[model samples]
Target: MQIAIDGPAGAGKSTIAKQIAKTLNITYLDTGAMYRAITKGVIDRKIDFADQKAIAQYAASAVITFKGQRVFLDGEEVTEGIRTPEVSEHTSEVAPIPEVRKVLVQQQQRIAEGTDVIMDGRDIGSTVLPNADYKFYLDAAVSERAKRRYEELQEKGGLNGKTLTDIEADIARRDYNDSHRAVDPLVCCDDAVRIDTTHMTIPEVVACVIDHVEDGTAK
Candidate 1:
């Protein structure tokens, strides 16, 4: 069975999906990280994000790994490289490309083969795993999301000296792109259980999801 979690940036998809996957004894795949990895590839290869052919070509040949919670790109252990401020900016540019999303979707589907899996991203509920047994759409207010992202970047110390204002602006810009993309845009599936996490804690959010699942209303 595959449980898909779809949400915007900083809506707790990664943390929540990981927790739920652990409880259900399933493998957790962070699809957003894959896009981020590809974004990093664009940076390394100097491919123009708007050039669909160029981005698609790089994505087609990209290698990504998840050793538990760690992410790697190619032969190098880019677990940290892909999450840099630079990748954060270019990932939105890369994520909306039709060809790039198609390639990543195929890779994501392949990872769910023969395993109980939980995958999270902007379009998982709508595009990647439309038939997922359990679908969740997590969200938070824009200001709240901006705050969460700001704090997270502060903790990671990966902002590369960028200001909090810069981070917030970048996240907001990505939000617009994600919601308006022509292919596999960010949308909450009607059947997906929506959880507004603006004022909720991690454990509280996880419990709500668990309760919903146990009651068969999560989808």
Candidate 2:
């Protein structure tokens, strides 16, 4: 049972994917975190973003794993490390590189080969899991998405001096970049169920997704 959920940042993809996975007793794979892990690695190694070859090579050799909600790189835990604002800022740049995507997508596919997995990211439905048993595309207004991100940062005390406006602008930039990238850009699959989550609470959104999954299963 493979479920692919695609969405831009802060559209609640991770939160919703986690909930659905828990409810269905399946493994949840944070594919965005995998990209973020590579981004964090490149930043830590002081590699220039313009050097795609170098970044791709790094990604090829990166050992990313998930244990519960924690992310690990090369046997070291980097859950909180990869979530820093710096890593978040660079992840968009790293994710669009075709070579990097090739390496990571292969890893993701291998992980889902036989497991009951729920994976979420920008291109999961369109690229990583095209034949997934279930596919969903979740989206919300940029302002609402940014507000959620701002609140999350506030709770984590990791705002890093960024204002709500700054976060909104950044999200807008990511939406454009992710959608416009040449290789497997963010897209809603033809068969994916699209959900506008701007006015819905997490529970509402989760229930909607569950309803779809149940309806499909019943068919």
Which candidate gets the maximum TM-score versus the true structure?
Answer: 2
Lowest lDDT sum, 10 consecutive residues, model 2, at 210-219
Listed in order, each prediction's TM-score against the native is 0.94, 0.97
Give me candidate 1's TM-score against the actual structure.
0.94
For model 2, what is the alpha-carbon lDDT of residue 172? 98
Off by over 4 Å in 1: none
Best by lDDT: 2
Candidate 2: where are CA atoms >4 Å away? Answer: 217-219
Model 1's number of clashes is: 1
Task: Kindly list the per-residue Cα lDDT of model 2 for residues 111-169, writing each as its tens digit.
Answer: 99989999999888888989998999999999999999999999999998999999999
